[model samples]
Target chain A: MTATQLSPGRVRKTPAGAAAPGRRRAFDRYLNPVLGAVGVAVVLASWQICASTGVVDPKFSSSPSGAFGALVDSFKSGDVWSPLGSTLSIVAWGMVISIVAAIPLGLLIGRNRVLYALTDPLISIMYSVPYVVFLPMLIFWFGIGADARVVIVVWSALFPLLINVIAGARNLEQSHLQVSRVFCASRLMTLRSVAFPATLPYILAGVRQAVGRALIGAIVAELFMGSAGLGYVVQLKTSNFQTDDAMAAIAVIAVIAVLLNHGVAYLEQRLTFWSRTD
Target chain B: MNDPRRKLVVDDLRIGHWSRRSGTFALACDGLTFDVAENAFVAIVGPSGCGKTTFLTALAGLIPVESGRLELNGEQISGPSRDRSLVFQQASLFPWRNVVANIEFGLKAQGRLDAEGRARVAELVELVGLSGKEDKYPRELSGGMSQRVNLARALATDPDLLLLDEPFSALDAQTRELMQEELTRVWQADSAGSGKTAVFVTHDVPEAVFLADRVIVLSSGPAHLVEVVEVNLPRPRGPEVKRSPEFQEISDYILSLVMSQNKPGRRTEDHDSNAALSR
Candidate 1:
């Protein structure tokens, strides 16, 4: 009764006989980026030094500034945007398709023992085979068109999302499920209230993996008989012995991948806030 | 000692699970025949692995009965129903849901939750002494606080029979004692109004004696009802009741019964006493 009179926040602030909140390590939040920046600076400096001192052949290795110059040149020429756009579109659609298809399938498989028994082996086999190894088959089937690239991206992205989602559903806490049953909750109600929210953190984790794989899939697909993506630009430039231009394209792709991953991570943190605190 | 308005009846009930690892049926409890009168607080005590949880699950209709009869309010208990709400040992509050939202979960599931339901939840929050912590998520709560939310949530549905499975076992001793007191208060509150019957399961003898009007003891591994000792101690029980001679005597008696059941190849000294009581 006394505890109720004070706000819950103050109750938390004024720890009773219960456990006190654990103090975070010094500079916990800022330490990661600060250390990361220092590491990146060292790598960049070493690369610049190597390129400048001619320790590595310029034909094979472009200095950071040279790559930057090529990046500006490509942008000014107005030719890079379309390829960049194509790559982005491919990744976006591929991830969307994978997520939409995988989550429901994962839920079904996770919930249904019969369905899981029947398809589990097939799923495992498909997952085991590196999806990129299917590039030749995809190109042959879809004939080097955007269809082939999209298929490759979808294939690459699908398994991680599916596996993680299945895991999420499968690993649902028995106690939570029991709570639902005790209430006589409908199946749909149980799914919405317990299963879906419980699986969210796992699903977000899957998305993180899917984003990385889908991006790689898009680029890899473009490398094989494609003409309108950043990967194509990189391939085209490299084959023509334009290492700086190829490096520039690679740089853009890396930045995009990092940003996309960070975006998903931020969303994951916001949505599954309980996981962090718990 | 007997009431005409019986809320529950479990006669010759045999409960078990199919052990896939061993490919055999494992019995948890058999011949669990008992009647809980309306508004009675019944506590079940037994050794660890005595199917206390399994018994609760059976009452909740989570697990199917192998061969037995279970009736609630003159109706056959077939499956999990909203009429019987359960509070698990762990708080089992949805990690994603805040305290108030968790309390509202059962109401929301039944679709009976409305603006008026908010007041019901608020009442439960106060009843469990968790009024201010309504918005805090389960993660933000200590073990005792989470279990309070769990109890509040169970009470939300206004169930006919409240099934509890050692709901305070996970808390520290002090917190557990506090929770026991809180539960007695809540039960007293419900006692006057709906007369909600509760079957509380625990291994703690003192806890059983303090809260229950009657404590049912079971033997482990294919658990059988061994004894049901009535606590003649005064009600509106507080911490002072725990120190009373009557409370200590009953607690010691149940402890002796439980300890005897745990000893391998030892004769049960209270067997005749239990059989005579049942008769």
Candidate 2:
């Protein structure tokens, strides 16, 4: 209302000593990208030199330029979509199932001492052990179908999310719960409004972990049992000695992984912005 | 919601908690008997770790009465009810919510965030001197600002009784003093200017004297009734009221009572006894 006082949430709009950080801010903003680009360029230049100079067989070790050309070729020929779509769909479905099932189940288990006791050892084992060891059994049960692929993805993704949600729920602040109790909130209201929001930072953290695991699960499934997907494409092309195409598919996987990670990180920042100390 | 005869009764009250670690009962308040009349501002004071906080908490229906009659309007409090709200010692605000949303939490929780409820919330935001700061998140607020939000959230519900547990204890000296005055103003201004029943629990002798119609003193841990010192200070009081001789006399008396309860060698002197001697 007053000219002197800016609106709420805008209190931090102008930091004191603003004149000082100008150069530092500019340096911080551009330094990372510029350095990253140079690092990448050097690696590509070295790889190209090795391949063209016959230091390594191009058939076995594809050059960065060759991979890029093969990538462009695959996209233009419309041969990239089917595998890409398959892998993405499996990851999406797995994430959906993990999120839906884990949050409620985690909260329920976390809140109840008896249930938490019953499941703690089981969950710890599942989360700590490599999911790859279970792949053979899952394929035996579900038979390399899309169902098996989705199940594998969920298997890899679900435990991390569940663990995080449970930890978050268990760590609910006593004071916050007291506020809810004093207000006479209904059980459902307490769960939805209090417990859920209090646990949001943890939930987002879990989601970040789950997304990475989900991608790994999808790729591993495709590599071993998938007749479709970029992972399968990479495997098949490598066997055929078309290393350039194989490297191109691997490059696509790397891009997907990076994009997915960045997307989750962005979401975490937006959703749990309040939790950040800085 | 108004009943002229509405009152809180605590007759020979006992409160305790069962600690599973030791598998034994830890008594908090033992046979503490006192009653707060309709719309009276009552303060309970004692040494640190005394059961003042526990007693106030029991009155809010957060902890069950182990025995004796602890009733509001002649009904026993079995659990936390909508009739009372507590201003916690720490400003336990939800960080995700802005000041306005945090103030609106109680109303929203009780499914009472209708038009009138929103209006009251807006009024409380102003009452607590947090008008322009309404959109600031908890992380964005200072210690004093967040406590204002905490007070507003409690007041927004318009409960029959309000319980405060040393709400200003965490603030710095100057801010605490300023807030104490703000509290007196807000307490009288809100609830249609009638000032609803308030039970404030604090270890601050001066604070207890400055605010309450009656200051109930409790002895250290497993607290029992020590003395019920009624403050006969005039209405519409301010910080200047604390400078009055009557305020000094009363606060000194209460302070001596509290200091006496502690082990004889524990404190050198926590009060201005020179003023007491001069008086």
Among the numbered candidates, top DockQ falls to 2
Model 2 chain B: worst 10 consecutive residues (lDDT sum): B270-279
Report the lDDT tens digits of candidate 1 across residue range B1-279. 234456688789898777655666767788887788788899999887777777777788877788887888877788889888999877778888899999999999999899878789988888889978978988889899999999989999888788988899889999999989989988888532654789999889999999999999988757888988998888788899988888888899999999888877533232322221111
Q: Write the per-residue lDDT of candidate 2 for residues B16-132, one digit (tens) a residue.
A: 776555666767778888777898899998877666776777787777788998888888888788888999888989988899999999999999999999999999999899989
- Which structure among the candidates has the greatest lDDT? 2
The sequence of per-residue lDDT tens digits that candidate 1 reaches over residues A1-278 is: 00111101111122333353345433454578899999988998899999999999778988888888999998999878999999999999999899899988998898888988898888888888998777787787898888788889999889988888887787777778878888989999988788888888878888888899999999998988797899999999999989999999999999999999889878887887776532
User: Over the full model, what C-alpha lDDT does candidate 2 score relative to the true structure?
Assistant: 0.85
Give the chain B TM-score for each candidate.
0.91, 0.91
How displaced is residue A125 in candidate 2, in Å?
A: 1.0
Each candidate structure's TM-score, on Cα atoms with residue i matched to residue i, is 0.87, 0.93
**lDDT of model 2, residue A269:** 68
Q: Candidate 2, which CAPRI tier?
A: acceptable
Worst 10 residues of 1 chain B by lDDT: B270-279
